[model samples]
Each structure stands twice: as C-alpha cells, then as structure tokens.
Target: MTAPASSSTTPINKQVGFINAFIAATLMGFVGFFARHIDAQGDFIAFSRMMCGGILFFAIIAYKGRLLELKEFKLSPTMVLSGFFMGNCLSAYITATQHTSIANAVFFIYIGPIISTLLAVIFLKESMKLATWFALLAVFIGMMMISGLMSIDSSGLSFGMQFSEKTFFGDMMALYSGVGYGLFLFFGRFRTEVPGDVRAFWNFVFALAGITLLFVFTKPTISQMTSTDWMWWVGIGIVCGFGALGTCTIATRHLKAAEFACVSYWECVVASLFVGLMIYGEPLSSAQMIGGAMIIVGGMSEVLISILGKSFKRPDNVTLKAGSI
Candidate 1:
C-alpha cells in the first residue's frame, strides 16, 4: 500500500520536524571530518555514500515490513527530476571543491536556500512572513561573514572579492550545485504524495547513478582505497548520507520550503564549528562567532516567536487532548 500524503501537519508535527531538521543538520556538519579522513576522490566518496546509504535505506524498509511499497513505486516526472537535481547537488559540490577555493564553493552552494525560498514563494504560493524576511537577511549576512566574503577590519568593513578565470569552471559548477539543491527542495515539496522514505531511496538511487557516470568519465582511482578508507566511506554513508538526508526528507513534509531552508542553515553553523574546534583546533574568529549567533537566532526566530505568542494566549487551565494535535 502507498503511504498517504502528510500534508495536514499539526503544530506538534511541525515542532518534531524542526527537531529532526536540527539533528540532520548537526549530522551533516561532520561530513567534512569524514571526507578529510577518506583517501578517495570527491566523486568516489559521493558514489560510496549513495551506494551504502541506499542499501541501508532498503534494509530499514524491509525490517519495517514496508518492502512491498517499492513494488508499487512508479517513476513520476517529479521524482525523476528531484532525484536528478539532488544527485547533481552532491556531485557538483564535490567537483567544485576540487577546482576552486573551499570558501567560494561553500558560499555558492549555500545560496541554495535563497533560491529555494524564492521558488517556494513564487511557485508554491507560500506567504513570506516579516520575521522570515528578516531571518533570511540575517542568515545571508551571517553566511557572508562565515565564508570570508564580507570581513570587518580596522579600516572598516570590506565586501569585495575577486575570482580568477582559472577557477571559472569550478565557480559555475558550484553555482549549478546551488541551483540543483534549490530545485531538489522545491520538488521534494512538489510531490508530497510519495512517502519520505521512498523519495529518499530514489534520491540515493539516482544520485548513485549520476555519480557513477561521473566516475566513468573522470576515472578516479577507486582501486587504491584501503580497508580504512572503505570504513570511512561507510561512516560517511551511514551518518551524513542516511542519517542526515533521511531526516531532511521527513522534515520537508511538515515545514514550508522557506522555513525548512532557514532551519537548514544550521548545517553551515555546525560545520563551521566542527572545522574550527575539532578539525583545525583553531579558535573561532570574531566574525565567525557573530555569524554563528546570527544563524542560530535567525533560524529559531519564527519558532521562538510562535512558542512565545502561544504562551501568552494559552490559558493556564487549558489542556490539549491526545486527538487535538
């Protein structure tokens, strides 16, 4: 039997989605750590991630007695398109990193949120609240700070950065990755009839296919990987791939695209923290601290406002029934 659409989400469900999104973001933050330890190329690692994650996802469904769901799964245009976009998002991002500076790649990749927000507003007709606008601006500024594109100096704030033609292809790839990411988020919401698990599984399937094609073209040295490398690849698959994207897929069911995009900024913040504290052992710069705080505040602004607003209006004697939610 097909899973029903989870369109009528309650407040409690939204809160749960928020929590899952947060956890997913946190897990995604450690991806860099795993990538650093793996001796494989970016595309190969991405391939391994999709391969292992897809297998694990299938296993989970079987364990849950939902394997029959796959038998009825038919390819929809939305599913195929979304899967393609997600695949490109992952592979293009890694390829971009190999060609350009990490800062440039990250800055461009995170632009996906802004694109997603715009697409949601235009296509999904989701209303943009005032707080959401402010949050978006704050998060954008925070990203600029964290990415080193906007810096504060004794002379004053400087905002200009130059790019070289040598990295032009990489920059374009990064921008394409952002577009792919945005499109994936949009299409994820577009086809809510599909269960989250099924969507996620197809995502891995298409992603693996795309990455494998890339491998065929680039011919990465996958044969050189050792047992330790394989272990790291598996870790990346289980943690960043399955753990993060699985929850993220679920989150899209309860949250509007824009809201989810804002919440997803937590990944950048957590990743920055991981790099500064765990990987590099470097202290966070003033800009980073400010940026991180802004991201947290901006991301939580709507939820916090909603909670506080409810508290003021809710009666002390009122009790919610189990069925009310």
Candidate 2:
C-alpha cells in the first residue's frame, strides 16, 4: 500500500503548487495594464505575447530535455487543425483583452465550462448531476451580472447592463474564444495516444508557428513600444508561459478534475480583482462582488457534488482509471 498524500508531506508541496497558480493568475491580471501602455499597438502586444510565451514554453522544454518528445507524433492533419483552433483561441483571447477590461474578458471567457459540459452531454453521452445543473445556472446568472447585462438604471447606464457597441463586440469575440477553448479541450481529450503535456507542448508549438505567420501577415511593427513594454511582455512570458502551464500540470497531478476546475475559478476572480484594484483602482460594484461570489459558489458546488458522488467523478479524478491526454 502507498502512503496517503496528507500523511506524506505532499500537501505542503501541493500548497506550493497552489501558490504558483495564484501568482500566475495575478500576473495574468496585469495584461490590461500592459495593453493600455502599448500606444496604438494593441494588436502587436496581443500577438507578441503568444509568440513570446510560446518561445519561452519551448525553451523550457528544451532545457528539460523533452524536445525529443516532439518526435513521437507523426503530425496528422487532425492534430494540426486542433492546434490551429487552439492558436485561434489564444489569439482571440489576447485580442479580447485589448478590447475590454480584464475582469470582463476573463469572466466572459469562462463560459467555456458551460459550453464544454453541454457538448460532453450531447456528444459523449456524459450526464451532469442535478447539482451540476444548478451550478451551471448559478454561473450563468453570475455571468450576466458581471457583464452588466442583467439589469439597468433609468438613465440607461446601470452597472450590469452598460452594453455599448464595443462591449458587445468584445463580448462576442470572447464568446467565440470560449468556443474555441471548449473545442480545444474536447479535442485534447480525443487524443488517446499523446501524453497531455506532450500534446500541450505541441499545441504551443503549433500556436507559435500559426500565430506568428498571422502576426507577420498583419504587418505589426514592434518598434513603437518602449523597453518597459517589452519587460511587461517578458513578464507575460514568464508568468503566463511557464507559470500557468506548470501550476496547471502540478495541480492536476494531485487534484481531482473537480478540484482542478474548482481552483480554476480563482483565475477569473484574481484577474478581476487585480484589474479592479491595481489597474483601474475602480471599486468593485455591489453586483460584481455578488456575482463573483456566486460564480465561486457555483463552481465549488458542482465540484463538491462530484466529489461526494465518488463513482460519479470524472475519470481524471479517479485513481485507478486510465488517464486522458
């Protein structure tokens, strides 16, 4: 028999992993700050983040002697297509950040989980529990509240319903990004042959190539930004590149799928909080605070329900099950 994680001092190690994830999320929150500083070069900033982050990702993998892992794949069109979709997701996400507040951007993109779950139910015949449905409903309501779409003031400028043309376009792009993200996850799950990390690495590589070509095609000049902006770009590389990816890999190692998903809710909150306090210094509206709380509560509720079901938990969470890539 093996030792329990709690008894083996691994919990402390896991706590360290959680801390990494928090820092990663927080640094990601600063994207808006960096974006605002670009001065007529928001598109370049968005493109460069992914390209630079992808380079950092590969560089780390090379240092770790995992470049040979890339040889295992024969490079099928399907994988390439999936990777292109993944690239689009990342590119669209960065683009969305330029158009809207990070709080709104992150919150809006999380519609992925809902879309992913529904897709699983329809395509994979996976049924969510009743509690999960409640969780979904709660998340939907929270999204509306956060987006300023749920209500309005008499002057047509309420907290939640303050939709302008730009806001609508931004939100729509974010929704598309979420769909690409959902499809990316679904496709990632489809690759039974590839290891998850290997798959992740290739996705990054594919994204680097695809987005770089697109970036060049767009003809963005990087000469306009300052040294400080480049430094922020580097921060985006380190924080989001290795930090988010590493924390996610480590967290998933010791966590249930529900646990992983539960902790992920923190990404949006941390992003939003950092935006509200650090970037804008705008106080959180009552609706936003309440909505944020609701989203967390809902995500946690679904996760806990999964845990309680034991047998009902996702295969990723089960100790003896064949793992997914």
Candidate 3:
C-alpha cells in the first residue's frame, strides 16, 4: 500500500497548498475589477485573455518539458467543442459585468451547476437523488429573487418587479454564460486521455483561434483601447486567466475536491465585497443577499450529497460530480 500523505513534509505542503488555493480564488474574485477598468468590448477582452493565457500555458508546458506529451495524447474533438463553449462563457461574462452589478453577474454565473446537472440528465441518461431535485428548485427560486421578479421585500411579498433594461439584459447574458459554461463542463467529461493542464492549454488555444475568427467579421474594440487599458487587459490575462487557473489546478493535487470547493465558494463572497465596497459601491439588496445565499446552499448541497454518496457516484454521471475549470 502507498504511504499516507501525513509524512513529515505533509504539514508544510498542506500549508502551501492552502495558500495557493486562497490566492487563486482571490485572484478570480478580482476579475470584475479588471473588466471594469479595461475599456474594450467583451469579445475583444475575451480574445486577448485567451491569446495571452494560451501563450503562457504553452510556454509553461514547454519549460517543464511536457510539450512532447502532445505526441502521446492529442486533444480530442470534444475538447475543441468544450473550448468553444468556454469562449462563449468568457465573452458573455465580460459583457455581463459591463452591464450588471458584479454581484448579480457572479451569483447568476453559478447557475452552471444546475444547468450542467439538467443537461446530464437529459443527454447522458444520468440519475440524481431527490435532494438534487430540491436543490435545483431552490436555485431557480433564488434566480427569480435575484432578477427582481419575485422577492420578499419589507412590505412583505412585494411584487416589486422593477428591472432596468441594462440589468435585465445583463442578467440574461449572465444566465447564457452559465449555460455556456455548463456545456463546457459537459463536453469536458469526455476528455479522459488529455491531462488537465494540456487540456487547458488547448482549450485556450481553441478559444483564441475561434474568437480571432469572429474578429474578421466585426472590428475588435482593442483598436480603440488606450495604453492603460491594454495594461489592464494583460493583467487580467496573466493574473485572472493563467494565474488562477494554474494555481487552482495545482491545488487540486493537494486537496480533496470537497476541500477545494469550500475554498472556491469564497470567490463569490470576495467578489461581492469588491463590487459593493471597492469597485462599484453597489450593495446587494436584501432580496439579493437571500437569493445569493440560497444559490450557494443549493449548489453546495448537491456537491455534498455527491461526496457523501460513495457507491452512488459514477464517473460518467455528471450529476454526481461537482467541478470548476
């Protein structure tokens, strides 16, 4: 049998792992900050991030002598499709951030888990526990609350359906981003041969190429951005794109998925803080706070059930898994 991970260096390793995970999550939370500062269109921002991050990802692989690993395992067609979905997600998110409050954008983007679960049930013939169904309902209710369609305002069950046009469009974009990300997750399940880092590298490569093709029809707003904006774009690409992805990938090797998830959820809370207190100064309304809580609880409930249900889990069943990439 292999030795337990509780060796002499285990404590130090665990400490480093926790720090890396925290840093990664914190950097992800700063995505809205960078997006707000960068004066460019969403697609252009997405393209820049993908191109720069892909370069860095490939450079790291080459430096580490893993570039030749491509000969042993090429990216699958499914991975290319997954990358396309990821590009959609990134593009939508940047646009949503520009139009909506960061809290709303981040909260709704988490709907990916619910969408991915439903897609798995429909497409992959997966089964979910009763708890998973309830969680889905909770998330739906939370979404309605966040959208201002349904809320428990101070007047008690107020039908204060007041959604500005920009926010409404932004909320829809955020929801679309979640669906795109859900599809990305769904397609990613089929890439069993490619290592995670290699898959990430190619995913960004595909995203860069796909987004570049779109620019041929429409002018990229990058042409209008100032030098300062370019700096911020680079920062987002290196810090939020590559830095967060690379560190989070490493953290998984040291921590259980459940432990890493607990860390990952903090990204939303941290983002809310930045959005409300630092960046936008727009606090989450009472209804939105309750809704956000429900969303988090619902998503985490499904994940917890999966972790606890040892025998009930299956590798091919997406409902029984919780992942972020």
Candidate No. with top TM-score: 1
lDDT of 3 at 88: 78
Model 1 CA lDDT for position 126: 69
Ranking by lDDT: 1, 3, 2
Per-model C-alpha lDDT, please?
0.75, 0.55, 0.63
Candidate 3 clashing pairs, residues 3+ apart or interchain: none
lDDT of 2 by residue, 216-267 (tens): 6556677766788787766665666545543443443343323334445555
Predicted candidate 1 versus true structure: per-residue lDDT over 45-105, tens digit per residue? 7776678768988887777777666656576766777767877788889989999888888
Could you tell me every candidate's TM-score relative to the true structure? Answer: 0.88, 0.71, 0.70
lDDT of 3 by residue, 193-227 (tens): 34546767777877777777767764765567899
lDDT of 1 at 267: 83
Off by over 4 Å in 1: 1-12, 305-325
